[model samples]
Target: KPNEIVVVPGKVLGIGKLDHPVTVIALDFSSSALRKIKEAGGQVMSFNKALETFKDFKGKSVRLMKQ
Candidate 1:
Protein backbone atom coordinates (compact mmCIF):
# COMPACT_ATOMS: atom_id res chain seq x y z
CA LYS A 1 0.00 0.00 0.00
CA PRO A 2 1.13 3.57 -0.56
CA ASN A 3 2.37 5.70 2.32
CA GLU A 4 2.74 2.70 4.60
CA ILE A 5 5.28 2.60 7.42
CA VAL A 6 7.61 -0.37 7.52
CA VAL A 7 10.27 -1.18 10.07
CA VAL A 8 13.20 -3.37 9.15
CA PRO A 9 15.24 -4.86 11.98
CA GLY A 10 18.36 -4.93 9.82
CA LYS A 11 19.73 -3.04 6.87
CA VAL A 12 17.69 -2.43 3.76
CA LEU A 13 19.33 -3.00 0.41
CA GLY A 14 18.26 -2.05 -3.07
CA ILE A 15 17.59 -5.36 -4.73
CA GLY A 16 14.15 -4.58 -6.06
CA LYS A 17 11.80 -1.74 -6.87
CA LEU A 18 8.84 -0.16 -5.10
CA ASP A 19 5.62 0.51 -6.97
CA HIS A 20 4.23 2.68 -4.19
CA PRO A 21 5.55 5.13 -1.63
CA VAL A 22 6.24 4.16 1.97
CA THR A 23 8.01 5.27 5.10
CA VAL A 24 10.88 2.86 5.73
CA ILE A 25 12.37 2.71 9.20
CA ALA A 26 15.44 0.58 9.62
CA LEU A 27 18.68 0.26 11.51
CA ASP A 28 20.61 1.00 8.31
CA PHE A 29 20.05 1.39 4.60
CA SER A 30 22.31 1.00 1.61
CA SER A 31 22.99 4.07 -0.51
CA SER A 32 21.26 2.48 -3.46
CA ALA A 33 18.28 1.62 -1.31
CA LEU A 34 17.97 5.20 -0.17
CA ARG A 35 18.17 6.47 -3.71
CA LYS A 36 15.67 3.99 -5.02
CA ILE A 37 13.23 4.66 -2.22
CA LYS A 38 13.34 8.38 -2.75
CA GLU A 39 13.02 7.93 -6.48
CA ALA A 40 9.79 6.08 -5.81
CA GLY A 41 8.48 8.92 -3.65
CA GLY A 42 9.12 7.07 -0.43
CA GLN A 43 10.65 8.26 2.83
CA VAL A 44 13.44 6.73 4.89
CA MET A 45 14.32 7.15 8.54
CA SER A 46 16.50 5.71 11.24
CA PHE A 47 15.03 3.66 14.05
CA ASN A 48 15.58 6.43 16.58
CA LYS A 49 13.84 8.97 14.42
CA ALA A 50 10.98 6.61 13.83
CA LEU A 51 10.61 6.12 17.56
CA GLU A 52 10.11 9.80 18.13
CA THR A 53 8.12 10.53 15.03
CA PHE A 54 5.73 7.65 15.24
CA LYS A 55 5.40 7.22 18.98
CA ASP A 56 1.67 7.41 18.69
CA PHE A 57 1.25 5.08 15.77
CA LYS A 58 1.80 1.85 17.70
CA GLY A 59 0.21 -1.01 15.73
CA LYS A 60 -2.21 1.11 13.79
CA SER A 61 0.07 2.05 10.91
CA VAL A 62 3.43 0.41 11.47
CA ARG A 63 4.66 -2.92 10.16
CA LEU A 64 7.59 -4.94 11.43
CA MET A 65 9.38 -6.93 8.77
CA LYS A 66 11.01 -10.26 9.38
CA GLN A 67 12.91 -12.56 7.04
Candidate 2:
Protein backbone atom coordinates (compact mmCIF):
# COMPACT_ATOMS: atom_id res chain seq x y z
CA LYS A 1 0.00 0.00 0.00
CA PRO A 2 1.09 3.59 -0.50
CA ASN A 3 2.19 5.67 2.48
CA GLU A 4 2.09 2.65 4.74
CA ILE A 5 4.38 1.79 7.59
CA VAL A 6 6.16 -1.59 7.29
CA VAL A 7 7.05 -3.46 10.47
CA VAL A 8 9.69 -6.14 10.38
CA PRO A 9 10.15 -8.44 13.36
CA GLY A 10 13.76 -9.16 12.50
CA LYS A 11 16.69 -7.31 11.02
CA VAL A 12 16.58 -5.51 7.69
CA LEU A 13 19.35 -6.26 5.24
CA GLY A 14 20.46 -4.25 2.25
CA ILE A 15 19.91 -6.45 -0.77
CA GLY A 16 17.26 -4.69 -2.78
CA LYS A 17 16.04 -1.23 -3.67
CA LEU A 18 12.93 0.65 -2.66
CA ASP A 19 10.83 2.36 -5.29
CA HIS A 20 8.96 4.73 -3.01
CA PRO A 21 9.12 6.29 0.41
CA VAL A 22 7.93 4.36 3.44
CA THR A 23 8.24 4.06 7.20
CA VAL A 24 9.99 0.93 8.41
CA ILE A 25 10.00 -0.37 11.96
CA ALA A 26 12.32 -3.24 12.75
CA LEU A 27 14.27 -4.84 15.55
CA ASP A 28 17.54 -4.03 13.84
CA PHE A 29 18.92 -3.03 10.46
CA SER A 30 22.16 -3.32 8.60
CA SER A 31 24.13 -0.12 8.03
CA SER A 32 23.62 -0.36 4.30
CA ALA A 33 19.94 -0.97 4.78
CA LEU A 34 19.66 2.14 6.94
CA ARG A 35 21.46 4.22 4.35
CA LYS A 36 19.37 2.89 1.50
CA ILE A 37 16.13 3.47 3.33
CA LYS A 38 17.10 7.06 4.10
CA GLU A 39 18.22 7.60 0.53
CA ALA A 40 14.78 6.49 -0.59
CA GLY A 41 13.26 9.15 1.67
CA GLY A 42 11.96 6.62 4.14
CA GLN A 43 11.92 6.66 7.92
CA VAL A 44 13.24 3.87 10.11
CA MET A 45 12.17 3.27 13.66
CA SER A 46 12.41 0.71 16.38
CA PHE A 47 9.68 -1.67 17.45
CA ASN A 48 9.19 0.18 20.72
CA LYS A 49 8.93 3.50 18.95
CA ALA A 50 6.33 2.11 16.59
CA LEU A 51 4.25 0.88 19.49
CA GLU A 52 4.58 4.23 21.18
CA THR A 53 3.62 6.06 18.03
CA PHE A 54 0.55 3.94 17.46
CA LYS A 55 -1.09 3.45 20.79
CA ASP A 56 -4.17 1.68 19.40
CA PHE A 57 -2.25 -0.77 17.25
CA LYS A 58 -4.26 -3.84 18.07
CA GLY A 59 -5.74 -4.32 14.59
CA LYS A 60 -3.72 -2.35 12.10
CA SER A 61 -2.46 -3.17 8.62
CA VAL A 62 1.12 -4.14 9.31
CA ARG A 63 3.04 -6.09 6.70
CA LEU A 64 6.09 -8.23 7.52
CA MET A 65 8.84 -8.75 4.96
CA LYS A 66 11.25 -11.66 5.14
CA GLN A 67 14.78 -11.88 3.81
| TM-score of predicted structure 1 | 0.88
TM-score of 2: 0.82
62 Cα displacement, candidate 2 (Å): 2.3
Please write out the lDDT profile of model 1 over residues 1-67, one tens digit for every residue.
7888988999999999898889999999999999999999999999889878877785657789995
Task: For candidate 2, write residues 1-67 as lDDT tens digits.
Answer: 6457888889999888887778899999999999988888888999888878988766666778775
User: Using lDDT as the measure, which candidate wins?
Assistant: 1
User: What lDDT score is found at residue 27 in candidate 1?
Assistant: 90
Candidate 1 residue spans exceeding 4 A from truth: none
Model 2 weakest lDDT span, ten residues long: 58-67
What stretches of model 2 exceed 4 Å from their correct place?
58-61
